[model samples]
Target: MSVLSATDVRRNWSQFNDDIVREGPQFVKRNRDEWVAMSTEQLKAAFSNFTFHAHLVQEDDGTITATLDQFDLVENGSSEKEVLEALTYELIEYSQEYMENFKLYFHSPNRKAHFPYILNVVAQDHPENVRQLITCQAGVK
Candidate 1:
């Protein structure tokens, strides 16, 4: 791995972009902070997923628009509590990386209609879980 100062990164952004395109990815530092990485593949994958979500709901702005109609219908349509509990359990069972990606999915600029609903379900009855998620989002350990 390579570390770079923010100034070096800013001063040579084009070079960095070329590196990302030529190589797989490149590490970028900003203000002496290990802020994030630059990767053509990673960005492409993220945006592609976002596009898939947009297509699911016919949104042109590239945001998620997951209406209740998008979810699987219950046999008799249960209460939100039951649905939330089920989803929370699934989230807890999945790896932390999955949950982190989920957070990103929800916070996309082109947010899905049901994105908030999904987050609410995942956060319910799990304050610690929610905090952990926030920590991950803030890039804190």
Candidate 2:
């Protein structure tokens, strides 16, 4: 769904883990020893094959809300880090709808030409059918 931080996985271990208990299979190093999180299916699908972008906002009361640029999805949390973690599930749950935006993106010549290189592509470009994309989240609130 979305890339997660090693801190995100550490802070919420259970949420990052699952029945498939293979180490490092669901993570990619960000820098040093820090890692970015992903689902098994996401891994097989090649997380790097697609680009996904997000927008984070700090609300009036200090809560943070993260929204995917490609989707009409919003996730709230106490911090930017937390919002990012929550974005993992927000993406999967709203995947189908989010993908619809691609249709629009490709339809408009200007939009398609100006599409950011950071947005994730749909399964068509990916071609690999990820059978199990586990939904995960954390205590971002």
Candidate 3:
């Protein structure tokens, strides 16, 4: 609940950073804008509950297809591993695009709910880390 002015934070950047590391997060207000500063670890923990759930199906041709339940994305490959890799790649790209146009995507009604999931994806340092967050289940289709 403690909010510091932007000037104070700028003047004590080192202390501000140290405080965030020790206290978890720090809030700063500048003009009409308010921002929270926290470590990447904190960000990851905040969205850890968010996950990507996918439905998997084996195609008639023997390929495996995965469709994400949370996002409008699908991928197919020769094996489950390959399909998961492809889907994860697509998710990463989508998350990055969503962030690049945050205002547009965040304001949309349907996409608003995607914020936490996008944050979870962004919190990951690598594609493999993101991949581990996804859970897959077999689908009839």
Candidate 4:
């Protein structure tokens, strides 16, 4: 509710940043445009409750396949570990591409709901961290 003018934010940029770090997100208004400033940690924490739900299948060939419940992304590998790593990499790549084409993706009916999951992936910033969030359930082969 405490929105600061763009000019005031620019004039006290350092203090504004400090305030955000100490007090969480801050809102700023500029000529019909509104923005919220917060640290990466805050952003990550905001989406911490989101998780990647995946279905895992053991192929007859002894390989493993994982398919995410939230997105149309799948990965196959020789082992569960390899599959998880590959899936994490795919997620990071997808999240980056989603942000790169945010407007297009955000407007798409099927993709709009993916925002929180994408943010969760982006916030991790590493494949290992992302891997930790994936919860896999057994799937009938």
Instruction: Show where candidate 1 strays beyond 4 Å.
Output: 44-141
RMSD of each: 16.1, 16.6, 1.5, 1.4
Residue lDDT tens for model 2, 1-141 = 345566666677785676224444455345566454545455435544445556666778989877655445688888865666666655554454435677875676655542322133233233222112222232233
Cα miss at 77, model 3 (Å)?
Answer: 0.7
- Candidate 4: residue 53 Cα off by (Å): 0.6
lDDT: the better of candidates 3 and 4: 3
* Model 3: residues with Cα > 4 Å off, grouped in runs: none
lDDT of 4 by residue, 34-93 (tens): 999988899889999889888889988889999999799999998888898999999899
lDDT of each prediction vs. the true structure? 0.42, 0.51, 0.94, 0.91
Clash tally for model 1 = 8
Please report the candidate that would top lDDT against the real structure: 3
Per-residue alpha-carbon lDDT of model 1 for 77-113, expressed as tens digits?
Answer: 1333333343334444432333567767556565444
lDDT of 1: 0.42
TM-scores for every candidate against the unseen true structure: 0.31, 0.37, 0.94, 0.94
Error of 4 at 128 (Å): 0.8
**Per-residue lDDT for 1-141 in model 3, tens only?**
889999999999999999988888999999999999999899999999899899999999999889999689999998889999999999999999999999999999989999999999999999999999899898634
Ranking by lDDT: 3, 4, 2, 1
Q: In candidate 2, where is summed lDDT lowest over 10 consecutive residues? A: 127-136
